[model samples]
Target: MENITFNHIYTLGNIVFENEIYKHYHYPEMLVRYDSNFLAFKKMPSIDEFKAAFTYLRNYHMKHGQSHVKFTFPENQKPPEGFLEYLNDNDFLYGYNELYEIQPDQFPRLKDNPDININPVTAENLDAFLTLQYTFDEEYGEEFAKQKVALHNRNFKDEQIMQVLAYYRGLPAGSVDIIISEDTAEIDQLSVLDTMQRKGIGGRLQKFVMDHFPQKTIILVADGNDTPREMYQKQNYQYVGFKYECIKVFE
Candidate 1:
């Protein structure tokens, strides 16, 4: 098998993003996902080009009813000189995300529980899946929750996305959505209820998915400042790289 490269990961990530966003603009210097109000550069550009890119993105998004927008620069790509200064001068909120990947051999196997069952979500249990998904979004505020609801409404029908649900002793405990590409499996939106955390539910759900794609590389992105990154580290996921993001949410 060929070794998985960052470029492969980058391309797959954009595929996933495009599906969720629905519309996009692919420019030589950057790719923009419209409905999500997001953009990312393939590589750094000259200061004049960078400024023009920003102006183009802002104008396009604003015309489309998105007042606020976000841009991400992958660590694998060179950051243009003065990129940070530009963000600061514009008063954009900034953050980073850690990208992790793993192979089957490195996947951890947790103790099996006869009481726990993880299964692919089907139409029969679709409502149950939505309940947990919406519950997970509650903390993020109503607007975020609404956005998630809309995303999932579209995502559930996408053939590339595999939805899994975990039941603990006959009750829904957690769920995950895996985005499948030709050679890689990217886990998107893995969530476990607060009351279900630390009971091995999350690990079992992850392992269940890993078992399905033994020959493919698994990928996920974690917030650089979040505890989930620590949990992923414990699962033996390699930190390949990260991307810094600049976001401005219009009031």
Candidate 2:
């Protein structure tokens, strides 16, 4: 986060977490976030320090107790060959993958199903949305959701978070956050919790947004292998580009 222009919610600054060992950021729900490419640590690491660094990361996740925190290292800063093994030893479900950007038209045509009833994420339904988000993560990205919620609850704004918690039939089923930067509207952080999957909730949620916003270009990040890619492709979204998930070494 150093040398970058952004509104940081982390008082420890956009550097490391309070303990100094775990480096992270509190991303607003709708806004796209990226590391400044500024190294979280001072230098490339020696093998001896790898254990301690991974330990710190593990503790960092435990301390925060929820939500997945991502540390982006430069593509050139390689970890020791056994680094991922170290993470596995600590029960970290680590997977390296691509972040694909899909366009709206590519997503499926809405069944326009009657099973779904979409609504705004107001303060009255925040807890439901949060709970729904938890269930969603548990089903699809349980561990990742834990870290994400933990970090999100502690470090993000109530209103901003609500913006990502739109309701469906009085239950928190899914959400798509909207952000206006300069002249463009960025659609992001869309999530449909578990128990609601395949219920047409996601399509309904987004379709409602499109109904209100027909001319806007919706944007977001999805795992290259996530099944949601099929959904996005059905939404008429073209693959504009991609963002790499590189390793961020803090040594």
Candidate 3:
């Protein structure tokens, strides 16, 4: 992947995540919630700035009864010297995530499921979109599901975003969010119901997004340790690079 293009995708994703959190929480500034309550920064601080940043976040969360601290860096970037060791010394658990990308032209031909129809979400179908998302995410527990649905609802108000829902024989079966930038189209929070897996609903939705923004580059991130990255590779997405993530949970 082109390095500039890759960075653009990463920056766009950070903006998308931060915006979603702000809208969901009704906060004025860019902030994110992880593990239910702790707030996180959109961009990683440099090594020299890490301590002050960490202290502030820690104090705010601890004061608010939040018990976790998390930090994520963009691909090919490293945290400040001893950042991981500091977290380790402080009992912070850490991990990493894989970032993936695909050109619309490179996406494989999806098996057209005649029964499935993917459409942009509008006010008329907003409820269906939220319900489908809640169903797919409910396993994460009620609070997470509720927040996710709320995030999507808030994202709908953003002109740069296009929320999609796939219907199988008149029932919502899958959903995804597309964040459109001038040069790229970033796909986020793609989900299909458990019962609808392996039925081509996801691929159909993917194709729908490509068709919707035929000229822009498409990008997404997947868990490095999970099966989804492999699946994305099979669908013609490339494993461009990955970022390291570290988190600490307070006792």
Candidate 4:
């Protein structure tokens, strides 16, 4: 497999600015989605450069009534000297994301459960899908949930995007959005209801992807600090690379 970089990851946001140092992505419709709006640095910068970039993103987000500033550093690159300490001192939350990919043959075959039925989101099941998404998004807040539903509504019309809901015994219990390209199927927003976890619903969802797109490479980004990455590894997904990111949220 070729080396994977952050540039290979799929994103729905539009790039608003790009230069030698960094690129800015913005999706005004989904202000609360950190992945949709962020500054991605191409290289580690001096403290002064970091501050300038932070100020620019902070002011840009504030102008749009957004309360967060996010920055993604170059993939597989260590931060500049004192950068982590600087972020900690300034109350910035920092983490990294591990990118993983798996071929169809590498993915394990999951046992099919009669109780679990996965379906593509369409007119007939859109409400159930939205309900499941809203239930998850509501953790952030009602307003954020509403906005996310609207964004999903827009995404539903896109030909490259496919949202699926996993029903456990006739109830929507898990959901994921797949962004398809010619050679890849990127899985995003995969979640299972807390009440229905540990029942193999998550693996079933991945099996759905494998069954549907057997020829394309399946990829996803996982929080480097989270347990889900461990699950991915156990499921035979290859860890490709990681990118560091930090964010500050205003009250």
Give the per-residue lDDT of model 4 (tens digit) for 1-251.
45555566787689999888889999977888888899989888778988999999999998999999999888898786588999999999998899999997888877768999999999999998999899999999999899998998998999999999999999999999998987888899999999999999999888889989999889999999999999999999999999899999999
Residue pairs in candidate 4 whose N, alpha carbon or C atoms collide under 3 angstroms? none
Instruction: Arrange candidates, best lDDT first.
Output: 4, 1, 3, 2
Model 2 per-residue lDDT at 145: 68
TM-score for each prediction? 0.82, 0.52, 0.78, 0.97
Q: Choose 1 or 2, whichever is better by lDDT.
A: 1
> In model 2, which regions exceed 4 Å deviation?
1-13, 16-70, 73-111, 137-171, 183-189, 213-215, 244-251
Tens-digit per-residue lDDT, 1-251, candidate 1: 56544445433222323322122333222222322446665555555755766676678766755566666665655455477777788788777777888997798878878988998988899888888888988786666676677667667898888989999889999999888888889887788888888889888888977899988889888888999999999999998887776787667
Query: Against the hidden true structure, what lDDT does model 1 obtain?
Result: 0.73
Q: Model 3 residue 248 lDDT?
A: 72
- Model number with the top TM-score: 4
RMSD in order of candidates? 5.2, 7.9, 5.3, 1.2
Give per-residue lDDT, candidate 4, residue 69.
90
- lDDT per model vs. reference: 0.73, 0.48, 0.70, 0.90
**Which candidate wins on lDDT?**
4
- Residue ranges of candidate 1 with Cα displaced over 4 Å: 1-35, 77-81
Sort every candidate by TM-score, greatest first: 4, 1, 3, 2
